[model samples]
Target: MRVLMRQSAFALILSGLATPGALAAGSHLVSSQKLDWETATKLASEAVRICAAQGYSVTAAVVDPSGHQQAVVKGDTVPLQSLSVSYRKAYTAFSYGQAFDKNTTSELINAKLAGPENGALNTIPEVLFVPGGVTLRKADHRVIGGLGVSGAPGGDKDEACAKDAVAELQGEFQ
Candidate 1:
């Protein structure tokens, strides 16, 4: 069958690639960490729920390590702008956190990039240098992604919701 032929061909390619130095002479495979959709959904929903419990309608977003949005949840009554802002915040936290070798919040990233020389980082479209953004990590401290919340009156308040959400789901990545 055509399907079996394709499978056999794929297996052959994989076996070849598995041999040492079989790939592109000097290049090698790269491994990355990421959150499954179910986990990302749980994280985003929990963030929004925590904020809603506080009488704040907010949006929460989770992004993969590569800065791709994994899941997003918007609390009832949250403004439309909160949606995109949430994603941007998550991207900023993940990207900057990886660069600094630490799980970071937007507040921490902002402070680290405060100097005049680093101001240009702000111009990056996906960079939102504010609180309410924090990197998500596994039990071994490997960052898998980020979470962000917005529309909670202040960035600090948003951050609290984000952190509480992570704490609530601590066992997820373990």
Candidate 2:
């Protein structure tokens, strides 16, 4: 009886660890599909509208889970320089599966596993480290892709425009 009890306890411990890993893997797969084309279009429209309302011509970019650009939008008055940055922001978020923060997170990753030296993150050209880009979240709040808006007053303003874009697509996203 004592040997049987010990065996059962070991099995339970192994099972507990395995359960969490299985759940995490499943969640990751489901969250990835949230970066669909329909969502991207709606979000892009939303960003364009917000920037227009704010009197700032802007460019917006949406990227997939792998950080590939899905859609790009530029307002008539937007500067040509804004287009590249806008695309880069979206790519950054999609590549990292997180929002664009100018802080140490990017630096830390870039130093360790990114850039042309490492042959990873730096693979995408023109991705900016500015704060305007944010990761797109699914119903479960999982980061699926990202939206980036540039050519506004500043990075924060660009971020706001992206948020407004998400708001425009909130119904479909939900």
Candidate 3:
């Protein structure tokens, strides 16, 4: 009877009918990759440099997958508001998986795809439905974080700086 019960339980576990830890003496292992501080800072710095080269004083921010600020680089002449805007843009990109391609998050939001009525995404706090934000993907195409650049006179210019920064560090992504 005991042998039959054990076999049944084992089968249940194998079939995923039982809870994961029901028959396990140890914990399950989980692994995920995240952007390191060094890489985040490098990205921010590169974005700022790119914007400066284009004669745009901007603030660049990098955020993790959890929408936490990883690094922020503010140009000497950038306004204080740019800091918040840059952070919001980064958070939005990280939350929405938006890339800095031809059509940015801002454009889509403005086009009503993610308008205020659509889950009120535009009304979300700390989310800037604007361009200048780009998702950071690993070589395996896993999104690890996001970068945002603000105060570049236009969203397109800011997006360009952010895109250039990510392109420059393409090889460094794991």
lDDT of 2 by residue, 59-98 (tens): 8888775567788878998898888888887766555544
* 22-125 per-residue lDDT for model 1 (tens digits): 33353345345577899999999999999999899999999986678999998889999999888887887877765565455655655575235657877888
- What TM-score quantifies how close candidate 3 is to the native fold? 0.76
Residue 137 in model 3: shift from native, Å? 0.6
Best by lDDT: 1
lDDT of each: 0.78, 0.66, 0.78
Candidate 1 clashes between residue pairs 3 or more apart in a chain or in different chains: none
The most accurate candidate by TM-score is: 1
TM-score of model 2 vs. true structure: 0.65
lDDT of 3 by residue, 55-136 (tens): 9999999988667899999999998899999998888777666333323455556665554555776678987778898877
Arranged by TM-score with the best first, the candidates are 1, 3, 2
lDDT winner between candidates 1 and 2 = 1
By lDDT, highest first, what's the ranking? 1, 3, 2
Better of 2 and 3 by TM-score: 3
